[model samples]
Target: MEKIKLLLTQYQEAILYIVFGGLTMLVNIIAFWLAFQAWHMNSSVSYLFAWFWSIFFAYLTNRTWVFHSTAHDLKTVINEIFQFLVARIATAVIGFVIFYFGVNLLKQDAQIWNIIQNIFVIISNFALSKLVIFKKKA
Candidate 1:
């Protein structure tokens, strides 16, 4: 029990990130399914819908819980939000490329390709958030 607690404490940020990231992925997947499967939207359009919702959810959870951001001032807050969005946009472009290649070019399943792209997005997003957006202040 003590060992588990220690480990949890040590990796609290990563643990919380995974938890929130999973929820974000769920939001993206569900949105994509509804748009693509139910509403019969184009795969590209559906991906955009999923990306918007997931990005919104991710920003909120990452700021409040995962990174525990402390940007109190208006300027700092704006800067943080800008940086976060930029980082997400960068990763989103990568996801779109992967999705386009897998689903459009190679004729793979849209759902599977979306999931694969998202895995990459999640990993890259974590790196950006930790190393750049949410880095500890010197």
Candidate 2:
């Protein structure tokens, strides 16, 4: 138990971020699929929906779990969202272009490439969320 606890704490923050990211990505993927396939939305519309989904979930999970900022409420969350978007607009634009090209244009069947692109977005998302959205304890 003690050893387990030690190991858990050692990787807790990283593990939480990873899990949260995966879940958030799941939200984005589902939204994308629904918008594109089910609702018959255009690629651009589907992409926009997915983008906003990712952004919202990224802010939410990162703030509540990764950063553990219990002090902030809805107003703070909104302000942080604006800041996060502003700082990440460039990174996310790049990420979206890469992801969209790979998934929609290239039609990448290789899971590796898709995963790699998603990792880039996740890393970029984490940086933005940490520095701008829900800053970690100082």
Candidate 3:
């Protein structure tokens, strides 16, 4: 975390966000791929498997490394966690629904839908984390 804070002065935190986001996306992709290819699960099940992994890792990384804040009390931690979960879960539901209708039902490319949803979710997650959970330093 200290190293991350030092890097923030020399590098854009967006780079860190992207790196973490990319790794977290890998978790999602692998989880979803396994659920679908191995178990032949439904789209929702595959999405949930991936989404849960992404959400958990994002929270862990953002709280411990990215924000680098140590002021969190138990109450604040719980509140931030609740908010983060709501934001990610809502995005997941929205992504799945849009993907279903736009890609699956319409027979369009699923990758396109997934990319679109990921973009939206990424922006939302950044704003929420920066503003609410791991707010900017004074």
Candidate 4:
């Protein structure tokens, strides 16, 4: 029991990050499905729409829960938001490329490619958040 508690305490941040990240992915999947399947939007448009929502959700949850960001000042908060968006935008572009090539060029299933691209995005986003956007100040 003590060992389990200690491990959980040590890795709580990572565990919370995965939990929030999974929720963010659910948002993305639902958004994409609605746009693509229900609204009959183009693949690229649906993907971009989903990206927007997921990023919005990710920013909120990641700042509040995952990293416990402490930037209270207006300037610092703005800076963090800007940095987070930039990092997400970079990942979005990479995800788009993967989706495009995998689904469009390679004739793979869109659903499969979406999952694949998101896995990549989640890993990269975690790295960016930990190393750059929400790095703890010394």
Clash pairs of candidate 2?
Answer: none
Which lDDT tens digits does candidate 1 get at residues 25-131? 89999999999999999999999999899888988899899898888899998898899999988888999999999998999899999999989988898989988
Off by over 4 Å in 2: 71-75, 94-118
Model with the higher lDDT, candidate 1 or 2 = 1
The TM-score of predicted model 2 comes to: 0.70
Worst 10 residues of 4 by lDDT: 118-127
TM-score-best of 2 and 3:
2
lDDT tens per residue, model 2, 1-138: 999999989878678889987797799899999999999999999999997988788776776778776545778767776886776677767866787787778888656666777688778767666565666556
lDDT of 4 by residue, 32-120 (tens): 99999999999999999998998899899999999989889999999999999999889989999999999999999999999999889
Per-candidate TM-score against the hidden true structure: 0.74, 0.70, 0.68, 0.75
lDDT by candidate, in order shown: 0.92, 0.77, 0.80, 0.93
lDDT for model 2: 0.77
Count the clashes in each prediction.
Answer: 0, 0, 0, 0
Looking at model 4, residue 120 earns an lDDT score of 93
| Predicted candidate 3 versus true structure: per-residue lDDT over 9-71, tens digit per residue | 666557778889888889889889999999999999898888788788888887777767565
Q: How does residue 40 of candidate 2 score in lDDT?
A: 99
Q: Find the candidate with the highest TM-score and give its number.
A: 4
From the highest lDDT down, the ranking of the candidates is 4, 1, 3, 2
State the TM-score for model 1: 0.74
